[model samples]
Target: MNPNDPKTITDAEWRERLTAEQFHILREAGTERAFTGKYDKFYEDGEYMCAACGTRLFISAAKYNSGCGWPAFTKPADDETVEEHRDTSFGMIRTEVTCGKCGSHLGHVFPDGPPEEGGLRYCINSGALEFVADGDE
Candidate 1:
């Protein structure tokens, strides 16, 4: 496996790198409790990146207070920033979002977003993201 590539990293390696909560949310496709995420109320100007692979996923400009108990975004950094999969887990049809580069589970996307901004809410997990405040890196 390429040490520099997230896509090639083994599960053991990922376990070594991520915390238990992060592993559960990112690797196991688990969901964090609503309103418990650090970024849920965080509004710093920055970019949200994939925690495992450091791939830029969302920008602060696209983020909004959707009151959904999680960090909500109008869109990704780009069309290829994240991938959406039809999730049927737990008997509910939802769209699962994942990091485009490493395929780490980010969260889910819902269609009940503000209609003005393309009407899509990218409800993402804070554990799946690392906020890089503007001018910090």
Candidate 2:
């Protein structure tokens, strides 16, 4: 909320810290249109962190192609960076993913993942993540 208060940032501060597009998607829960996200075709070894909070959410090793027009992962980078809750939004039942540290909405988890593992898919929006390139590792 309050981006500068350290507890939570004010909406005004968030607007200043992020571009209009980032703010719209991150703070306002606006979805980036399908197939247009930067990570849709990405294939590199790195970690994906929260764009707003810098908390690591996924590792490159967990990424996969679900043809869902967004970056998808079979699992999170770690179990601690995300929290899952049952979402009843849109009149459908689903598992919602949020940041563990700041509670920023990341995306949702589905059961249609790669069947070899468990068919669990963590469908994430690329706008929700800030990828730290492998070179930075």
Candidate 3:
């Protein structure tokens, strides 16, 4: 899906479309516990898309093991695929990352990443993503 032309899904539709855990994370901006997300340790050749809207966000090449208990990507598939906002929750300032297409909370981005790899860590929640393996479709 194009991030520029986001779909307008309603709350009722979202609740029905997603699982409880997925709804919590994508719709209510809730987070899954560290080390418990499905994609934290998943490494494969594929693309990661927003779980809610299926917008392409990250590719396997940009993913790395950051030991951050979440899927980490050095960069997005496209600059406009994700959106960032200043988050001041829990007494900490963070850059929250969301799917630009559906405006669903994906995770947060941090500055402490491999300097050789764009110097950014996009710490994303697995519950917020759906992976499409290379050659799968």
By lDDT, who's the top model here?
Answer: 1
lDDT of 1 by residue, 45-101 (tens): 999999988999999999999999989999999899999999999999999999999
Candidate 2: segments with Cα more than 4 A from true spot: 1-7
TM-score of each: 0.96, 0.87, 0.94
| Backbone steric clashes in candidate 3, count | 0
The sequence of per-residue lDDT tens digits that candidate 3 reaches over residues 1-137 is 44345456778888988999999999888999999999999999999999998999999999999999999999999989999999999999999999987899999999998999979999999999999999986
Residue by residue across 9-118, what tens digits does model 2's lDDT show?
76787778777767777777667888999998898889999887788999998999899988999998777988998988789998888877767677889989999866
lDDT of 1 at 111: 94
Where is the poorest 10-residue window by lDDT in model 1? 1-10
- What TM-score does prediction 1 earn? 0.96
Q: Which candidate model has the greater TM-score, 1 or 2? A: 1
